[model samples]
Target: MKILFLGDVVGRAGRDAIVARLPGLRRDLAADLVVLNAENASHGFGLAPDMARAFLEAGADVLTLGNHAWDRKEIVPYIEGEPRLIRPMNYPPGTPGRGATVVDLPGGRRALVLQVMARLFMEPLDDPFRAAQAELARHTLGASGSVQAIVVDIHGEATSEKQGFAHSFDGRVSLVAGTHTHVPTADHQVLEGGTAFISDAGMCGDYDSVIGMQKGGASIRFWRKVPSERLAPAEGEATICGVLVQTDDATGLATAIAPVRVGGRLSQALPS
Candidate 1:
């Protein structure tokens, strides 16, 4: 199975980039399933129902949210009706939308898509470890189970927490990628357990600013410990950042994983 997981989408630039490049990306990468983090798509805050529909229409099979999942008020109700869009599972038990979803693939195969948020340097949430365990308990992987592939998105502030979460479920899932930092890391590799792991996949917006925010305002707040105008996503050219994973058909384990960075300020990167 071939899976393409995109990072967070910032504002208009990120949305436009996804709308413009996703179809071509799906074709060029030959991705069987496409998952994207659309947490920051709405003016660099939370995602909207319209934005979710747009991403799904563009080619994203599933959309994941992070800390900013509720930044938009309307999303609270919109999420319940949209099965393809999911928020962090670690949110309180009554949180809107599901934390994990079973996506049926071609040839009668299926994949489980799950997301969890870490507590370190982040808003307190349910224990990610427990949340992941519960999902795995419900949907076992490998040939013995109905699921053929599993993708987990760890949204948090610390790399250590993200890496740890990925390792905790290393052999059980197909891939585990980090988000929320809006900065791609250099560590993209398959673990001994065959799970593909990346510290961060970066954001789907311009890299010229501070973590996708406009430079001017971000600079003022950073240099002076004071409030500036509301932070907005940079509107410059966007570079779609993410990773592609190739999994074994039988075991549903990752056989290969590589970073996908294209357009904008960063040098292009893709699996060979």
Candidate 2:
């Protein structure tokens, strides 16, 4: 199965770029599933139900959230009922929505999507490593009652923590991708144990802005410390940053891993 994981979608520009380019991308890559980080999709905050639906309609199979998952209060109910949407799994026990779910693909294959947040440089949460291990164990490939493949989205700040988590579940899961940094990492490869891993997938928004936020506004907030108004999306060429992973059916292990970039300042795509 071929899977495409996109990083944080910042705002209107990001959403438009995804909708405009995803169909061609899906065709070119022959992607079987597409997972997108939509924590910042709605005006760089939380995702509204309408925006979430738009993302789903634009070829996203599942949507993942990060620290900004609850920015929009109205989404609480939708999050609880939407199985295709996932928030950080390591959140406290009584969180509104689930952290993992099984999505059945076209070929009768089931893919497990799990999201976890790290503690370093991020809000403290349940032990992400332990949480991942338990989840992977439940969906181990080839196990009597296992799912076809397991994909993990590690939303965190520290690169070390993301790397450690990926290594910990090397063979147990099919793919482990990172998010929240909004900056794509150069490392993209299949682990020794067959899992596809990347430290960060990058952001899908304006490249000229400061991490997808308007530079002018962000600058003021940084230097003045006064509540300069909320940052808006930059108006310029947009880009889509993500990774493409191809997994083997028999063992549910990654066969290929490559970074994908299109439009904006950094425009490049993986070799077919």
Candidate 3:
């Protein structure tokens, strides 16, 4: 199976890129599943139901969110009703949306999508490692079970913590892709145990600004200690950044991993 995992989306530019290019990408790559981190799909904040629905219509199978999961109050109820949408699982026990789900693919293959937020250098949440292990235990990856693929989206800061999480489930999951930093990393490789790992997948928005935020506003806040107005997503043309993982259909272990960058300021990269 082939899985495409996109990084955090900033705003209109990101959404437009996905809506405009994802379909062609899906076709060209023959991707079985497309996963997107939609927390920042709204105007650099939480995702609204409309945006979520738009993403699904654009061919996203599973949507994952990060620290900004609840940035928009309207999503609270909408998340509960949409099984395809998932928030950090390690949230307090009663958090509305779930953190893990199993998606059935064609040819009797099932892919597991699990998302978690790290506690190191960020808001303290349940042990992400423990939560991840528990979710992995739900579906065994092998011929004995129909579950053929597993994709994990580690949404947080601290590359060490993200790397640790990926290594912990090295041989178990098909891919461990990071999000939240909005800067794509260069290390896209398959682990010895067969899992695809990338420190960060970057953001699907304009890179002309500071991490997808308007440069003018970000500069003011950084240049001076004074509190500046709220930051907004850069509206320039965006470069959709992500990773593509190809796994062994039999055991559901990644055989190859590659970075994908298209349009906007970033150099173009595509896996044939």
The model with the greatest lDDT is 1
User: What is the per-residue lDDT of model 3 for residues 237-262, given as tens digits with 9 covering 90 to 100?
Assistant: 99999999998877889999999998
Better of 1 and 2 by TM-score: 1
lDDT of model 1, residue 9: 97
| Per-residue error (Å), model 3, residue 254 | 0.3
Model 3 TM-score, 2 decimals: 0.98
lDDT of 1 by residue, 187-223 (tens): 9999988899998999999899999999999889868
Candidate 2 differs from the real structure by a C-alpha RMSD in angstroms, to one decimal, of: 1.4
* lDDT agreement of model 2 with the native: 0.89
Which is the winner by lDDT between candidate 1 and candidate 3? 1
For candidate 2, lDDT tens digit of each residue in 173-208? 888999999999999999999999999999999989
Which pairs, if any, clash in model 2? Answer: none
Ranking by lDDT: 1, 3, 2
